[model samples]
Target: MHITVYGDTLCAQVTATAMAQTGHQVLWCLVEPESREQLAKGRPLFREQGLDLLFADQLESGRLTMDFWEGNPQGLTDAVFLALQPGQHGLAAELTKSLASSTSTGCGVIVNQTTGPVGSAELLRDIAKQIDPRAFLVALPDLIQEGNAFQTFTRPDSILLGCEDGEGEALVRELLRPFNRRKDVIQVMSLREAEFAKLAISGILATRISYMNDMASLSESLGVDIDVVRVAMGADPRIGEAYLYPGCGFGGPGLSSNVLALVDALNERAAEPGLLERVLRTNERQKEVLFRKFWQFHQGSVAGKKVALWGVAFKPGTHRVDNAPALKVIEALWAQGVKVTAHDPRALADLGQWAQGRGELTLCDDPYEAAEGADALMLITEWKPYWSPDWQRLKRVMREPLILDGRNIYEPAFVREQGLVYRGIGR
Candidate 1:
């Protein structure tokens, strides 16, 4: 199928490449100009897993192509996927205006690849009718993240298709058939249902993380091990472990904002998600929970404390700092007049000039340098490099050997035996 993906964002490019690599003829309309020059030179715009190889192959084959024009989108394709951001979701209206003056002889179906509110599809459908009442508008939310985008796109857990008619739905089904090689990975539902499902899934996942973090705090107060409690509880087959792993907090705006959006939407309908509200509140406080522990361990004084921090990205696999708890923690520490040195394998360079100017926040080349001269060490991210440190060097260098592990990657007893005050969530 000939596919045209609208937008120049990470999701748009990844979606286009994912389709093209899987044998679809993809022409990307990159509305943003910055990405144009790079993509025009066949440059990999992202550091996703295995995308470079796939992009190279597709670009060489002329199967993957991109355009940086904002004019009327002229294309001949069986499908067009709108992967624009939330603010630019009125793509259907823009396309309708363009279609009035420009002509595209080819017939195609339009699908919303970007997640929006529950009623966004119908709004797009209405605008699409202005161009051609036959222009099919459906919802197919992309579930991929920053680092694992390409891999996830190629092997999505399931593809949810929302359509109004049998004819429009068939086009989407056939277009996405290549990705769903296994029998039935496509599930068709109403547009509203599919949109809510995406938000609902994220909300539930974030809730679990927050719930675990809350319990982890309580575990410390009660002298109970959360790992032991989690194991016993998980064996019930009802509350299996996935997002239940206690950690600092959920990354940024996406999931947590989705939870808030759900709550607001539910309230409008005179319904309430009581547990979800608590979950969000718990998670917000939990973002600071790690720092709170760190301060308490230092006897309410972070001043003059050379604290070493590891991992800046909200999660290990991604370089995104959106709603990153580490950033907030670092900023708070800096405000408190504490000496903070940090290292993130991927996010170090991307932290930008503002973070660079901070005299308190010193960026380190490696983990050991960050840990040097530190009264206390904090683990903000669960990167593999930060997991195991040379205990002898760590023991010798620091004045105060307090290891405040947020992710709980290291064994408590092992670090404790090294003459360090070891602390972790629910340990």
Candidate 2:
């Protein structure tokens, strides 16, 4: 079981480390030179929980090795995994061609975990087959959830495997046997179906979130608690609670890009305007819900005001802020001449980098420090540390005791009892 994994994505890291942990010798070919340099220095490239330690252990035990993507795999490689980022289709094709060219017998089963448009895997397979007819390409579309990526990969609820050939399916199944132990959760399908299924899953989840945000808006006008309505909706066995929370909005590399890809696919197919289009529009508007609340609370005279943001990461348990709602919120606040101070446990460094030349942003180590003398406090990411805070201290430090709960993590009545004005997405 000698596997070579390509790309510097979290999927690449997780796949390499997990396969090594399962007794396979894995050579991780990182696409980014910086990632290889950091790995050589024993520094973690990703901040996923427990991933660094496990990856380190595998490296120490000689089970996992790191190399650059520009380098060829040493000796005969049994399998290849491409976990590249979206828009790396050319790179994927190049890698498949190189592997196929180098292999005298076959390139083996090339598993594509990369996120790309439909038919991408088939295209790679066609390229590989030109060099070696035995070379097989399969699609194992990435379903890794950030923040909890390692656990989700090691124990996925189900795996979408796209393999047209019996031998390819058998090879990939053996490679993933350790993770697929619980009741055989692997759903076999055509390559195009597998890719489309992943995008459809993301689309539906985004749709649910946008739908909830839409309901939250209506709930506010009706003076009804969206949380209550959410609970009632979840009580239905048919609905089953998941991605139904009425937050400011949903943003991350995965959901946003997949929805956009789905939209593009629909458009290319000459489909009419539909739910997904509305879903994206609603989400964009929802990202500004907190900003609108602040402006309305101040009667539209919010220039030169100070606001504190509790979290900036797209979600809790990860340090990435790609397409995070906090960015939009910060931009809106800055346009209104509002000073923004933010605090997040792990995302400050990333947030600082993102804020470069965008506008003035004060990053604070402590949550209360961010809130100091601020007119309002906006909870953007709903990190666990921000769940329970020093209410009295927040009340004392802020110039105006205003709390805008974007994620509905705080109880509105309890926040008001602390003598602070509370404004949630829909309380």
Candidate that scores best on lDDT: 2
Q: Give the TM-score of candidate 1.
A: 0.91
Model 1: runs farther than 4 Å from truth? 33-45, 96-102, 105-107, 271-274, 353-360
Query: What is the clash count for each candidate, in the order shown?
Result: 1, 0
Q: Write the per-residue lDDT of candidate 1 for residues 1-427, one digit (tens) a residue.
A: 8888887566787888878877889988877666777667865556554766777778789998867656766567777787876556566457644543346546567778766677887777777677666666788876776667776766778777787878888888777777788667788898888888888898888878887888998998899989888888778788886777897777754576678777777777766557788887787777777678778887787777778888888777665677788877878787778888888887775554447666556888888888888987888888887777888888787778888888878889989888889888889
lDDT per residue as tens, model 2, 1-427: 8898899899999999999999999998888777867778876778877887898899999999987866564456788999998999999988888888884433568999999999998999899889888778899999999989999999999899999989999999999999988779999999999999999999999999999998999998998999999999999999989988999898889989999999998888865887799999999999999999999999999999999999999999888999999999999999999999999988998899899999999999999999999999999998889999999999999999999999999998998999999999878
lDDT of 1 at 6: 83
Off by over 4 Å in 2: 34-43, 71-74, 104-106
Clashing pairs in 1: 252-323
Q: Flag clash pairs in model 2.
A: none
